[model samples]
Target: MLKNAALQYYHTVCSPNISSLLELRQSRKSNFEGREHQKYMLVKWNEISPNTILKKIESNDVELALSTLVINLRNIRMNLSPEFHAEKILYAKLLQACRTHPAWTIACSTINEEDTAALINSLRSNVATWKAQNKPTIEQFPRRDLDDSEILFIDPRYFNSNSN
Candidate 1:
């Protein structure tokens, strides 16, 4: 009952009026603290309702500029070590960061198969979380009909009027 109530409150009350200004600020500041840091924006610019925050960026807060954003993102990616293992973005970001930093890539490559397996599992779970939080209506299935080589992005041309 408590869980249900909290979820309801999150979906309704907390979903609209309040944006995570503190989180945004913290993420921004952290990114700015390090030259190697990546850009981090909890609420995307285009997703921000028309006039609210974009205006700040446009007004030369300067901190909100695209260059600053890139910094925050890089920092976030590089600093992504999770306490819990089931976070895919952390792995993705680490992998990305490692790609740019040869030393990091060498460290990642030296890990044994067991540790690699665990990290991959955590990352896959994180991907699921991202999909669910970003697109609530999309259904996730345990098995996919498409094999690794058969994957393609959905396009209008792929649809058939009379076919299932």
Candidate 2:
């Protein structure tokens, strides 16, 4: 009976009418452009509180939280707003904590402290490079033509010389 049930289940899942499965897979693909997807991911991250990630770190679930924190940091690094700046700093600190925290040592844990530290350092360097590249340059004064006046604003009376 069990063998028959297993065979039936396999047949149903691997049937010739697999279009449903293909459609499901395709639907999961993102239609958003790179920047839009980043914004969407940021909005999703906002739903997850920092305290929850801290709790995961405290419980030695560093691997789970590390990726999230890293991505959050990378996403917000480009934002010049004060709130985003604060969140970026918080995420970086959390990532640092993940790197220094003792290894979980479980069979399921894939990353070690050294590896986490390396990833964090790489991300920090990338962020620094991005900031340097995107830094705002001082606006240069417009070049003056030879006949242009030094006076920025001319008085109306100066134009109408006959008016006393």
Best by TM-score: 2
Q: Estimate TM-scores for all models.
A: 0.21, 0.23
Largest lDDT belongs to which candidate? 2
Predictions: Cα RMSD each: 23.1, 19.2
Q: Write down the lDDT of every candidate, Cα atoms only.
A: 0.43, 0.49
State the lDDT of candidate 1 residue by residue for 25-88, as single tens digits.
Answer: 5544454433343222322321332123336466533223323433444444444333213445
**Candidate 2, after superposition: displacement of residue 15 in Å?**
50
In model 1, the Cα lDDT at residue 53 comes to 30
lDDT of 2: 0.49
Local error of candidate 1 at 61, Å?
Answer: 29
Off by over 4 Å in 2: 1-60, 81-96, 104-117, 121-164
